[model samples]
Target: MKAVLFKVGLVLCVLLSACSNSVDDSIDPETADDDLEGPISRPTSGYGVDGVYKVAELSFPNTEYPGTQVTIFYPQGTTSGRPTIFYAHPYGGEDKEYNRGLFEFIAKKGYVVVFVPYPTTDISIDHRYLTLWTGFTKAATDYPNIIDTKKVGFMGHSFGGGASIGLAYKAFTEKGWGQDGRLLFTMAPWYSYQISPAQLLNFPSNTKMVVQVYDEDKFNDHRLAIDIFKNIGIANAEKDFYYLKSSTVANYRYGTDHNLPNSRSAYDAYDYYGVYRILDALMDYSFNGNEAGKNIALGNGSTAQVTMPGYKNELMAPLEVTDNPSPKYTQSKYLFPCSSQENPRIANCN
Candidate 1:
């Protein structure tokens, strides 16, 4: 009887100890949202992750350009004058699958996201540019309440990035778009055409622009991005030349390449901090007059903009930011060399 009682007591003690440890291991629900100093597996704060507003999607036929389509996402039953963003996709990225998460993220945040996909097959760059422009203008006119034309942003990737420059130029010169507030977020852009360096000077000094380049990018040379940064008329204060660096944590790695921005293929911390966080802050600063967002968006090497918190209390590599980027033009290893492209409009290629 004594032996049985001792065995039972040992079992009970083990169970009680496990229960106590379990409670200790569990995260405290109340303080879970606070910033953690130690190892973390996932992002705790969903800054630009999801927003208050519910997303409502609309697709307008490309009346101006028949073969294309324009998709717009906005907050459901929202008020008028929502800050609008015109997004152009990368080359061959003719479907919303390329950036649907980002589009929904913006729309849910009470902003309008206009995604205009241009033709890649059997179409010239000029045709693609025109198609995007016409589709954008049509969407704005059709949904006047949803899209606030006065406060606008032009964002794109690769070929679309290059086109954003020309499109912003046309919109500003002709329609006074962004006279209220304008921002340009270009990522891994190719050789820009349809606008000259002199014409680049035509951009409003107040316009805010961020030219993002990836260190691992081998398609578009950094010189291409640097040239645009130098020639753009926006003052050094408003325009930023941003460079993303690749990071690794143990066995995992975050890529800083041309495809890193594409949320569909691979989504990771870089997308949240490097791309979404930066752009979200930028839009807020440029559109809604949010002064605090300026520290994160165009901080120009400020700690808020450069710091990218990662897992395991690890600080991801800081983004290289500056007004003037002196890229080594001779050291380019881009797959599409400047000399190889036939487009004569790219200023630096020749």
Candidate 2:
């Protein structure tokens, strides 16, 4: 047992050290300690303000798992049974300022937005999974009045985006979540572990999911996003894979990279139209049974879901979506897989 422990510890140290060298921690706006990065101009056309409830937010220090902090943003008037969103963050993305805009926006739209940052420095990615689950379970257990376990959504960006898949499986199977409604959204996600192929075949079939990949993200391979989009057990009708393209409106360009969801403070048209619009519709369709939301959120091939609003309500770049293995991101183009990522999880190399 001692010798086995030593090998695992040695491998984890090497993994963390190597990964720390590979990533630019500052690429995402984790620098902000407080407040949203200025004001975001909300689009008045799509995704109306269905939820104008004043939001109340609180942060909790985890005495049990000291490395993580869990914060909850919920409608101020809610007493219980509110739909919830469980958000996971990428590595080194512990600061709330990284996604404060999204959190506040979702909260104002009337959902319990839970943000939990997992440890990215010393622990194995598997332990990081535990940290995420610990924080999530802690929040749900402590605030049963706020989190409606039956109706919940799991979403994340980059590293968190990939992790959201494995975590959502845990949420659905163990907790019996999604009995009412569930949604999973991944934005330029990373390689996810802690979930076996068998588990991938068992995700809730009714779950609404969108695996979003950016056109300009040169870091994480798009194949990784394709992996989850293909493997997850959901049917074609229930899930969609989005290839978000970049757009230039006037002199300012909206680049769809790995960090579009993070926005680092200054949000653009994509944040409002490309993302938040569909997400709002997805939530409404899943949780509230709003049938109109299906066209915009999971709109099979509708013009509205595929097109994003650009300059002066003109045409922006449309999203490329496919449920099958896409030739655009083919096996020949498969660059970074488990073999090259050097993730200590060993599952990657498989």
Candidate 3:
């Protein structure tokens, strides 16, 4: 595939709009029924070491059967409370292996991670929104001591990355962050989903971080993710995009058709470092309340240090095209709720 620049550009425009409007959200249908549902089913197999402990077969009560299940990876010994993160899996994947390596790495740094496995077979945006909100809320309330309810972070890959953005929107609009606030981080987000500009506009003005790993993914995902973040930044939205050139998060990027995965060595050396940088940034902001200052101290050099030829072209071409809208919000799964008969116009979700 040469590149899908135009589609990428269109996505940026849609997301920019979401940053401006207030999202209209209701109680996640899955959580409407009250019950302290337990964890989902455990993972059949995975690796965990030292401070890291992996627990699979955890289930959460949902509209679906056996409840929506997921996994948890965190430090083995935490004498005190630890920051909690709700980790969403990548799209088209059955488990959390897409982020397993990174999740375990973060766990060692002193944090609890809830690896959520959404019903991927039914990975519609709305379904994800409901599952994520319900699951996260359940974890916060049920495991208060383990999960610092006041400090929460969301990280996801691909479609899961997109879900992280939506979760941020919900957290902010619903005042879920009122006590201590929350952080939103997305890795290699699938920006093609058709959410409206109104729905996409709010994040830039709030707290968020998006990390894009450049590789050979179709839909020009890397460049498109950068374009989306740049628009948020230009709009003076509160967020930054950490760009990694030619370093796939895992060897699987190009190993498959998308060519986005990196080698195990690259994943450990480069990809893990990128995640470390982001986690450090987040920890500083949440604990120190000086994210901007921390970035300044670390120096922007580390933030955007990847040096790759043709990188500028890869970033600009797609941005140039996406600035204009084509597929539009109508194509996205986000349903702009209906209005009164007298006012047939439905307000944009932004």
- TM-score per prediction, in order, is 0.84, 0.82, 0.58
lDDT of 3 by residue, 1-350 (tens): 11232343345334323311111231122212111111111111211111223322234554331454655555554434467777765544434554455665556545678766555445345666677677777766666566765667776766666667667666655645524645666666654243445656545343545445333344323433544455442232334555443322222221212212322222332332334444545655654476453452123343232221122233211101122222222312221111212111223212
TM-score of 1: 0.84
Task: Give per-residue CA lDDT, model 1, range 169-274, as digits (tens).
Answer: 8887888888888999999887687887788977877688889989888767777777788878888878788988887755567778677676555566677678
lDDT of candidate 3 at residue 42, scale 0 to 100: 14
> If candidate 3 were superposed on the true structure by all CA atoms, what would the RMSD be?
14.1
> Per-residue error at 96 for model 3, in Å?
3.1
**CA deviation > 4 Å runs, candidate 1:** 1-49, 63-68, 328-332, 340-350
Scored by lDDT, model 2 comes in at 0.71
Q: Which RMSD values do the candidates have, in order?
A: 16.2, 8.8, 14.1
How many clashes show up in model 1?
Answer: 0
| Candidate number with the higher TM-score (1 or 2) | 1
Candidate 2, position 313, lDDT:
57
Clash pairs, model 1 backbone: none
Q: Mind giving the per-residue lDDT tens digits that candidate 2 earns over 7-34?
A: 5345433433332011222122232222
Q: Which regions of candidate 2 are displaced past 4 Å? A: 1-41, 48-50, 64-68, 325-350
Which prediction has more favorable lDDT, 2 or 3? Answer: 2
